[model samples]
Target: MHTAITSQPLPSAAEAALARESSRVLSACLQTRSDAQQIELHDEQGATHPVRVPVSALRLLLDVLTEIGAGNAVSIIPIHAELTTQEAADALNVSRPHLVRLLEQGDIPFHKVGTHRRVRYQDLMAYKQRIDAQRHEALDALAEEAQRLGLGYD
Candidate 1:
């Protein structure tokens, strides 16, 4: 079964408050680099339950909360997950055929599963980072060349 992942709605007032609190807690806990911490949750029944959370998980939660606090929707995807070419293309914001060409050229790594290519989420992210770095370097070089020619913005 396939499940669609979508960004969540903006946080409500109460949620915003919780987000603030979570951010504060995360900031404090991250400084100590604690392995795990237990958080108390109080339900409508007035019963408190303690749940253990890893520091990494808490950090991710804080990031999500911060985005929501800023009125931005957020969604999470695991880095190790496998993705189809179409899904990878959608994530990369490119046409499927373009992505296929990239795959064919070995620009992005993929493995075939019964004739269907599957890309790892981490691999795609790594490729994106590489492309972004290359783009940044090229832009920097262009700016330097323009500056050398006295064509830079005032």
Candidate 2:
């Protein structure tokens, strides 16, 4: 059997880099100064580059990176709590038939608990999170365009 890629962080160098990045992320977040100027990104060479991003985007970035570093990233997560197809579908906000299609396509992992196929609850959550992120991105694009055009948002 092939060795599983443990979700655990890799060795020292990678871990250190992640820590440094996380620190920068935290610093960016802790900047509560009003009249916030444009964000200045410091490069490895100590060169400062100004980049303008909405505060909302920065906050979202902080949240996503923090979650990933905490091993709680919305990506595929192995779960201990097992659930049947119907249960998994409900957890994922999809229909049982849709889950069955995913099973047939070998898109999701599952085990046969005696006769019924079962999936991990964490896996269902991870899948839903992934789908939600994609939907959010598309909606964000439309919203951005609407904002740019001064079009109807409500």
Candidate 3:
């Protein structure tokens, strides 16, 4: 499997401002009923070029712009991509050893590549969603119990 890791520095204040403006404009443009839109780009030398972009791609670009405008870093991973233990751990915000334990315990679906283990991005996301839902359920139950006990929880 071919995996590409890309890391970019956070946007500067000026860049963020530009991203905010650009996203706002793109959002307005996307309200039209069309599969594709024509957008114009201006070069540094005062040259203009018109390009047609698919609506789906434009929507994705808008999302990226919005995140950058909010000063958040973004990374794109294909659903079918295979990730290393460290990469999967980083995606789940957990330690590598913990991810390894989960893999060994069959908590998440993974496969062995020779002697190394690789996790599919889709399987990892599914595991994360399941765990998050369970945590939410537990929290809700705890809150309900607290309310029943009249512990002054609003």
In terms of lDDT, which candidate is strongest? Answer: 3
Off by over 4 Å in 3: none
Per-residue C-alpha lDDT of model 2 across residues 1-154, encoded as one tens digit per residue:
1112233443355655585588576656658754333678999999999987766556656665665555452333335667778767766768999999987787777778678787877666677788789999999998999998989775
What is the C-alpha lDDT profile of model 3 across 1-154, one tens digit per residue? 8475467789999989999999999899899788999999999998999999999999999999999999877888888999999889988999999999999999999998999899999999999999999999999999999999999998
Model 1: per-residue lDDT, tens digit, 1-154?
2223454677788878877787887777677556988889999999999999887888888898788776677878787788888888888999999999999999999999889888888898999999999999999999888888999554
* True-structure lDDT of candidate 3: 0.92
Worst 10 residues of 2 by lDDT: 1-10
What C-alpha lDDT do the candidate models reach, one value each? 0.83, 0.68, 0.92
The full ranking of all candidates by TM-score, starting with the best, is 3, 1, 2
Among the numbered candidates, top TM-score falls to: 3
Worst 10 residues of 3 by lDDT: 1-10
Candidate 1 wrong stretches, greater than 4 Å = 1-21
lDDT of 3 at 109: 92
Which window of 10 residues has the lowest lDDT sum in candidate 1?
Answer: 1-10
Can you list the residue pairs that collide in candidate 2? none
Alpha carbon lDDT of residue 65, candidate 2? 62
Q: Over 4 Å off in model 2, which ranges?
A: 1-79
